[model samples]
Target: MDVLPDRAARAEFPVGERQLIMKKLIINHDRLKEARDAFARFHFPVVGGVADSGSISLVMGDSRTGKTFGAKSYLGGFPQRPGERGMIYPALLVEMPASGGYRAILENLADAMSIAHTLRMNNSVLTNNILRGLEFHEVELLIFDEVQDVCDIKNPRLASDFKRLMRKILNLEKASIVCIGLPETYGLLSSDKQLVGRGGLQYAFLHPYSWDSDEERKSFRLLCDQFDEGMPFLNKSSLGATATAERLHWVSQGIIGLLKNFLFIAGSLAINDGSIHVDTTHLAQAYDWIKPPQTSFNPFRDDWSKKPDTVVTTAPLTTHDPFAKRKRSAHAQ
Candidate 1:
């Protein structure tokens, strides 16, 4: 990622500077760091020409909570290197197709590994090619983003087929698998005893920060401070101030992606007006542009703190372990 120009150089910059700055910024917030650590733990190093059995790890989170971002960031750490045969990829990250069929899944994997294949190729051949490509590229970790598409299938037959394909991949022990999706993706492991048994069914979660918890509030404030420092402006924006942080949390719902976007617009507005720093006035205008017209609440308003409905809190989405009872039963046996 490109670093922004020095603060002194950024002063009195043109209106388009916001685009240049925001495009290059990539913040590794706390939750994203946790997700990366989980990926690292799942990857096992080979020894004495032998590797441990491939395991499956699930990374579940709400939309825009940085699940995909974190996965890609982990992939970025393992750049493709020149191998005796060709380029070796230590890790691969591919998205689950909306259709979520076995063939689509294989095609997506092939595309990511840069393996050539025709649309007419049979499933068996394609599967073999993908597995071979995984070995050929020496991939140690395979990440599947939007995995809920396959896990949430309504048709039992489709679901069974997908699970069967996954079991085969795990059996090969070519690479550890990481599935990234909504919390509902837990169903994939709960429904399949074989998968759970094979991988121990490890789980990781990414969640938006909340203002209620003191720890979470402090973390959110620190994130705001980091973003404030990252923004290329002549003067500090004081984004981490108590009042400002609360307003930012309100508008972005503590999601980093949303926060970055909201701030980008606000920063652009400030730049356009030749302001030295982003202010509430610019934030107010940016919110109007990004939010729906029917939204009555504006956190940037003077009386925002006094408004009755100024803060709206919603519980984070969570998954209950469907296998808890089964595990207890097995232990009793």
Candidate 2:
């Protein structure tokens, strides 16, 4: 694909309309599609009375590399439907609990499947309930996001127990398992001789684009082009132009999630200011808005040839705390 396309007419839309457009935009690049395809390869229809061994696939990447987004996008394609027994979910993606353990994993699974269980229920009972749910739902694919937590367990016994549970689930052949997490998650199946020997483990790595090679640079630019085309603005952003692409790459470090956020903010700034298309100034202000005040190196304003010493960092957007905080009485002191 061409790195740059011809500019189009300007969009004349209200600020709210423009913001809504940006919110609904979904850009699917080559790498994201490849990850989705890998998931599809492992998913198979359930054949009655046949015990088909479930395959395990790993999708590993650093944070903000679109690992979870890609997996969830693929899962979204297969909507749940009414089946003879119950609701059949063709694919289900569950997040791994922050406090990782056998029971935590089971609880997360139960929550995803909407299976009710009490604190009094033991692990065996929970596992049985989960298995029954999987069978009744006829879920063909199971995805565990943030799976690195499961691999980070320090206790060997706990890890072994988790692995055994996974094996039990796979032996049932109700669904194929896809573990999505940081790169270290590859170790989840590396030491398991039975899983490895079965030749059912597959690995896919999602990485941010690096400007170290000609091919990599071209690919990154092409991705920029795709994102530019996907934007809702009527006028082309020329994001793939040499100067703009360099600035974008420097700002986002070629992470699609960051790039998407950056562009949305920049585009919003442009639309809010009654501008036809995004400019470097809008991007500069957007950078200031999204990042910490101490982050002074604005890629939009700086020379793209001279990369910054530090990477751009985003500030936390919300102050709301989900966990309970300890409170002290006024008279305690």
Q: What is the lDDT of residue 123 in candidate 1?
A: 86
lDDT of 2 by residue, 89-146 (tens): 7788988776757798899888887899899999999999998898888877788887
- In order of appearance, the predictions have TM-scores of 0.86, 0.81
Look at candidate 1 and give me any clashing residue pairs. none
Instruction: Flag regions of model 1 displaced more than 4 Å.
Output: 12-14, 44-52, 308-333
**C-alpha RMSD for every candidate:** 7.6, 9.1
Model 2 residue 165 distance off true place after TM-score fit, in angstroms: 1.5
Q: Model 1 over residues 1-333: C-alpha lDDT tens digits? A: 566677778664664665677655788679889888777766643333433457888898876788888888888888999999998998889898877477788889899989998978888898889888888999877888887776665756656766777777788887788888888888865678988887788888888888877798899998998888888788889999988998888777788877888899898788778788899899888877755444466668757545444333221332233112110010010
Under the 3 Å rule for N, CA and C atoms, how many clashes does model 1 have?
0
Best-performing candidate as measured by TM-score? 1
RMSD value for candidate 2: 9.1
Q: Where does model 2 exceed 4 Å of error?
A: 1-10, 44-52, 155-158, 198-200, 289-296, 309-333
